[model samples]
Target: MSEFAFEVALCALLERERDEIIARQLGASVHGRRIMDIVCVEPGPDFAKRVAITPHEIPDAAIESRAGVGQARYYRNCFDMHPDRARSVAERAIEIGFFERVRQGSRLYVRQTARYPDEWFGKLVGIENKPDLAVPGDLELQLRKDVSLGVFDEVILATESYVTGAHLNRIPDEVGVWRFRPETGGLEVVREPTALDPAASGVDIVDEYAGRTDMRVATAAEKARLRRRMAERAYGKGWRSFDLPPCVHGAAKTVSGADGIPYCEWKESVVNPAEECGPACPGYEPADPPEIDIEAVRDRRTPWVANPKGPRTQSGLDRFL
Candidate 1:
């Protein structure tokens, strides 16, 4: 079906109720605006009986169901209802912030922050916000402007890497001396061990590591880009139980089926940290190596991922079959 056709089908399916299902599917994209709720485009002849929506303004949908592919009714509703548009109905999905093109990656991940509520993110996968890592923006805007507070009093410190131009460190604690610049909107935390205070216990600044100090500053856009990239990196997954996805760099073994066809290994998790299943499947066991002919495995995968926006579905289907 065309994107518009699928959207109309989805709307018809959700005409009465189905928001919980919608929220369940499209909730985790972090970096850009995704259609969390139905955006009712301006009504027209094509939208007569349905609740037409354009998820994040992408021609494709923000959510799909494993129950069935291209099954519009099975997946519908905004998982992250934009606060500004929280009160809106399915008919007005647009006008909240539907940029046609997003600069970030495929998925939209909500920024991990203490301020994010369970209602907004439904209990994020990881509670910790990577310590004091900051998104690219004006960190210390001086809420009062005139009522200056000590740089040490600031709750979080956001900075850049001295060598890699990457997000390497977050101090997250007490340091003896620090500086904040109003003109450049930058922060510097210093740990000189001279005058013997709380952090000066070892007092080995000049004696131990003299030139070990490092500093870095990155532009706001650069920091935002960095955070976006980090969010996409899959990590800390419990390999067993089939409840979590494997790391992007992880390798999984494949095998041939009775029909002599090889298939790539794939697993889906409904819960988390799945319990060890014992001798049979062994919850965390590495996938089995392919039992198929070597040439069969080599010839299976297409050069690229299947693109829905691409044309010639009939030819594509034949290649896979």
Candidate 2:
């Protein structure tokens, strides 16, 4: 199976089996360019509170700003970033119902609709998918980076190849291994992962050369911020992030109870619409995209809420403006 197809199948299976929020191809590193294949965000005590806030991602800048629920602060004073960036962040926050804004004279003041939930998500499990382990491109290095960073609670490597001692020895001991079959939707744990300490400071491998390697130290606080940002993004952006192709043969295929998978009839399997479907293909025929309500499917199948009532009312300043 292609990596994209394998990833979608695994995500579908995981969504059906686990209650955690599943997201695909997310930036998981704090200061490095590490993109995780799949991320599983387990809900914490305040998961419901997060769901009540908004169905979209609350801007990290807005969340990190000085704005609070009890008192409104000068919009510009709330953020440490540039004035233009701050204004943009505040606008997004207000639009998403996470913040309420009011204009006083020519200045704008803002406050959180509700206090940001610190414990909205629990352990984050980062999964790396390499269906064919024979062509393991940067697999060992990526797993090493994840282990050293300790950003994820547990790191796992998922593949379709048969396990061998040589393959296991190449990766870190802390990392777990999973043999998954996309055809049968079967997952076998080859090696259990050791829990990493997210509260401790971590070392990020910045770059590597023939002789020397550059590195940066990430504080626990930094990791915490990244974790929050990642979880919020996962909550807003689920695994079904792809668009269905606008080809006659393209359709939404149901796999493991999760709908909205981009399946091509001509290919007779899951396909990466962005790369595979186009006028270049011989099977291509112009047609309206399939009417698949991905959001409704997510609402019905997952704990995520859609079009939820805002937790707080706006300040009613729009009418005056």
Best by lDDT: 2
Question: What are the runs in model 1 whose C-alpha is more than 4 Å off?
Answer: 1-212, 231-307, 310-321
RMSD of each: 23.2, 5.3
lDDT per residue (tens digit) for residues 104-171 in model 2: 88989999988888887999999999999999389988998999999999999999999999999999
User: Against the true structure, candidate 2 has what lDDT?
Assistant: 0.89
Residue 285 Cα positional deviation in candidate 1, in Å, after optimal superposition:
14
> 196, model 2: CA deviation in Å?
0.6
Residues 1-321 of candidate 1: C-alpha lDDT, one tens digit per residue: 222222222323322222211111121112222111121111122211111111122111121111112222211233345633422322232232211111245422221111111121111111111112244432222111101111111222212223122332222222122233322334355432121121111111111125552223333443333222222111011101022223331232321111221122233322122232223333445544323342232223311111223222223333222
Lowest lDDT sum, 10 consecutive residues, model 1, at: 232-241
